[model samples]
Target chain A: SQTIHQWPATLVQPVGSPLSLECTVEGTSNPNLYWYRQAAGRGLQLLFYSIGIDQISSEVPQNLSASRPQDRQFILSSKKLLLSDSGFYLCAWGPSGGNYEQYFGPGTRLTVT
Target chain B: AQSVTQLDSHVSVSEGTPVLLRCNYSSSYSPSLFWYVQHPNKGLQLLLKYTSAATLVKGINGFEAEFKKSETSFHLTKPSAHMSDAAEYFCVVSVGGPYNTDKLIFGTGTRLQVFP
Candidate 1:
């Protein structure tokens, strides 16, 4: 069975600080990875998605960026965090060229103070 | 362009009662629809998906949804609601195809509260 994992389950950072969140998938190769943010009492907003290594797409223009260093490793980074960046970050993976259904990781809750 | 709308921002129901979460969508092409549930402080879970196959889709936790093309709606339903059913539900629509990187448009989400 395939599983998605995310680190720093909870994070607290001061404003203007650098941020990094990691996501890795096991038992699957060449999977589609996505980054999403969910604000309090709101739905999810797609930030970035990668179909393969070094192929990343940004959905929204913001303070965040994404990279796919390895086949199953994806990272979301921010050079400087903003107060608006405080939210729950979710990582998801889907089978390449398969059904569009996605599986999500435990998620990272970031609080930018 | 693809978009999804979850009608109710919050719904309250008693345990053992039926559950109905309404969702409507708009898509220029053949759309793939999905329903995801999120417990508090947890990641989203795929409850079910409709990919141009059957109109009636059954998902985990004895939940099901019917796709009404004419209405452009995919509403999730459960015969009996449990306390565990209290969570936020999101309706999503995928734009593009399998060969390309499809984007998922999510609804604002509906918070379901089940009381025993």
Candidate 2:
């Protein structure tokens, strides 16, 4: 079975601090990766998605960026965090040939003070 | 372009009663629609999906959704509501063309509250 892992399950950062959230998938190769954010009581907001190494599509302009440095590794980063950036961050992936239903990781809850 | 609209922002139901959450979509092509559930502070869990095949799709935890293309609606339903079913439900759509780029667009979400 395929599974996604995300790190720093919870993080408390000061405004203007750098942010980095990591995600890795196992049991699948060349799967699509995505980064999403959900504000309090809000829906999922797609930030970025990567089909392959070095190939990424930005969904919305935000304080976050994503990269696929390895086949199974995807990273979400920010040079400087804003208070509004504090939210639940989710990492997900979908099979290349399936119905394209995304499977998500445990997620990271960020609180910027 | 593909978009989803969850008709209800919040719904309250008594436990063991039926559950219904409404959704609609706008797509240029035959769509791939989905419903995802999120517990408080948790990542989303895929409830069900409609990919132009079956209008009635059954999901885990006794949840189901009906896809009505003419009405552009994909409404989720459950025979019996459980407390664990209380969560935020998101209606989603992915563009179907080659340029569609499987990026899923989410709805505003409907908060389901099951009361005993």
Candidate 3:
């Protein structure tokens, strides 16, 4: 059984602070990874996705960036956080090929004050 | 370009009543549709998916969704609503060519509120 993990479960940061969120998957290899942000009342926005190591795609132009350092390890980072960057961050993984139904991690809730 | 629309931003239902969350999608190809549920401050969970097979799909926790190509809709439903079912639901569409990295387009989401 495959599982996705993310941390820290919750974080509170001041504006202009750096941000780093980690996601890792077990029981799968070469899976596609994705980062999404969900704002209150607003729908989820896809921030980035990676097909493989060093192959990252940004869906929205924002302060956040994503990287796939290892096959199953993905990281979301930002040099400086904005007030608008506060939201629930989600990490998801899908099979490399086929239907592409994604599985999500527990998620990280960031509050930029 | 592919997109999804959740017909309702919020839906309130009494416990034991039937639940319906409507969704519509637009896609150039035979799209793959999915319904995901998210509890408060939690990550989204897969409720069901329609991938070119089984118009009627059953999901966890007594949830189900029907895919109607003519209507371009994939609405989720349950016979009886439970308090635990109160959450936000998102309709998703997969966009990509035959050999490309598929991107999922998500709807704004419909928040389900189950009241006793």
Candidate 4:
């Protein structure tokens, strides 16, 4: 069975601090990875998606960025955090196909103060 | 362009009552529709998905959704509502094409409250 894992579970950071959230998937290879943010009362927003290593497509223009270092390892990073950056971050993986159904990780909550 | 609309922002139903959440979608192609449930402070879980295969899709926890191409709607329903069913439900659409890069568009979500 395939499973997704995300780390730091929760984080509190000050403005101007760096951010790093990791996501790794097991039991699958060459899977498409995605990162999304969910704000209170707002719907899920797609931030970045990677088809392969070193390939990333960003949906929204913001301070955050995503990278796919390995086939199943994806990382979300930011050089500096903004107050607006605070939200719940999610990682998901899916097979390469016309079907867009994805499996999600536990997610991480980051609060920028 | 692909988009989805969940008709209700919030719905409250007594336990053991029938549950119905409405959703409508727009897409240029024969879009794939999905229903995802999100508990409070939890990641979204796939409740069901409607690909081209079946018009009626059954999901976990006694939930099902029917894809209506003529009406462009995929509505979710359950025979009976359980207290555990209380959560926010999202309607999603995907128009997967050449690159498989078609983004999944999410609806505003409908909050289902199961009352005792």
Candidate 5:
């Protein structure tokens, strides 16, 4: 069984401060990773997805960037956070066999004040 | 390009009643569709998926969705609603093949409220 772990379930950051959210998958190696954001009660918006260690495709342009340092490790970062950047950030993963169904992590709720 | 539309933003039903949530999609090519459920403050859980294999797909928690190509709709239904079924549901579409690099488009989502 594969499990995804996301850190800092809830975060409070000052506007203009930096941001970093990490996600790691256990029991699954070399899996595809994704980043999504949901604005309270709204639909999820895809932010970025990585196929490999350095192959990343961004769906939306904003204050966030993603990196796949290791096969099972993905990180979402921002140099300067904005008020609009506050939302529920979710990390998801899929297997290399081309399964469309992705398992998601608990998510990080960021409040930019 | 593939896209999905959730017909209802919210649906309320009494416990033990039937549940219905509608979703429609637009795709240039043969698209793969999926349904995901999210509990409050929880991550998304895959309900089911359609890859043209079966017109009807059964998912977890006694939920099922039927795919209608002519209507371009994939509507979810449950025989009986449980209070635990209250959550937000998202309709997703994938443009590529079953095993390829595909982008997923999510609908606005339908929130379900089940009451006793």
Candidate 6:
């Protein structure tokens, strides 16, 4: 069975500070990785998706960016965070190709104060 | 392009009553649809998916959804609501094909409230 892990389950960052959130999947190789954000009382917004190492497609223009440094490792980063950046960030992975059913990680609650 | 619409932003049902969360979709082609659930402070869990294989799909936790192409709807239902079923439900549609860049378009979401 495959498992996804995300860390710093909760984070508190000052506005204008940098941000970094990591996600990794075990027991799967070359999987499609995605980054999504959900504001309080709202639905998820897709931020970035990576098909392979170094191949990332961003769904929105914002203060955040994503990278696939390794086949199973994905990182969401920001040079400077904004108050609007505060939200619950979710990381997900799916089988290669057009499989839309994805496995999601526990998520990171980022509070930018 | 593919999109989904969750009819109700919030629904309240009494325990032991039937549950219905309506969803409608729009797609240029035959698209895949899915329903996901998220408990408070928890990650989203896949409840069910419609891949054209089955018009009626059964998912975990006694949940089921039926796909109606004519109505362009995929509505979720359960015979009886449980307290544990109170959560946020999302309807999603796939926009890509096997040869395209795959991504999902999500509905605003419906919050299910099961009350005893």
Order of models, best lDDT first: 1, 6, 4, 3, 5, 2
| Clashing residue pairs for model 3 | none
Per model, the share of native interface contacts recovered reads 0.63, 0.54, 0.54, 0.59, 0.61, 0.65
- Give the number of the best model, judged by DockQ: 1
lDDT of 5 by residue, A1-113 (tens): 99999988999999999999999999988888889999976888889888889878888888899999899999999999999999999999988757777889999999999
Chain B TM-score, structure 1:
0.96
lDDT of 3 at B82: 96
Candidate 5 lDDT over B59-102, as tens digits, reads 99999999999999999999999999999999999755333555
Off by over 4 Å in 1: B97-99
Q: Is the docking of candidate 1 incorrect, acceptable, medium or high quality?
A: medium
* TM-scores, each model vs. reference: 0.97, 0.94, 0.96, 0.96, 0.96, 0.97
Worst 10 residues of 1 chain B by lDDT: B95-104
Model 4: chain B TM-score relative to the native chain B: 0.95
Which 10 consecutive positions of candidate 3 chain A have the poorest summed lDDT? A93-102
The sequence of per-residue lDDT tens digits that candidate 1 reaches over residues A90-111 is 9999888855888999999999
Second chain only: TM-score per model? 0.96, 0.93, 0.95, 0.95, 0.94, 0.95
Q: Write the per-residue lDDT of candidate 4 for residues B1-116, one digit (tens) a residue.
A: 89998999999999999999999999888888899999987888999998888899999999999999999999999999999999999999875634576578899999999999
Give the DockQ-based CAPRI class for model 3: medium
Against the true structure, candidate 4 reaches a TM-score of 0.96
Q: Enumerate the candidates' DockQ scores in order.
A: 0.71, 0.60, 0.65, 0.70, 0.63, 0.70
Q: State chain A's TM-score for model 2.
A: 0.97
Interface RMSD of 1: 1.5
Per-model C-alpha lDDT, please?
0.93, 0.88, 0.91, 0.91, 0.90, 0.92
Q: Candidate 5, which CAPRI tier?
A: medium
Residues B1-116 of candidate 3 have per-residue lDDT tens digits of: 89999999999999999999999999887889999999988889999999988899999999999999999999999999999999999999988623356678899999999999
Question: Which model scores highest in lDDT?
Answer: 1
Q: Chain A alone, TM-score for each of the models? A: 0.98, 0.97, 0.97, 0.97, 0.97, 0.98
TM-score for predicted model 2 compared with the true structure: 0.94
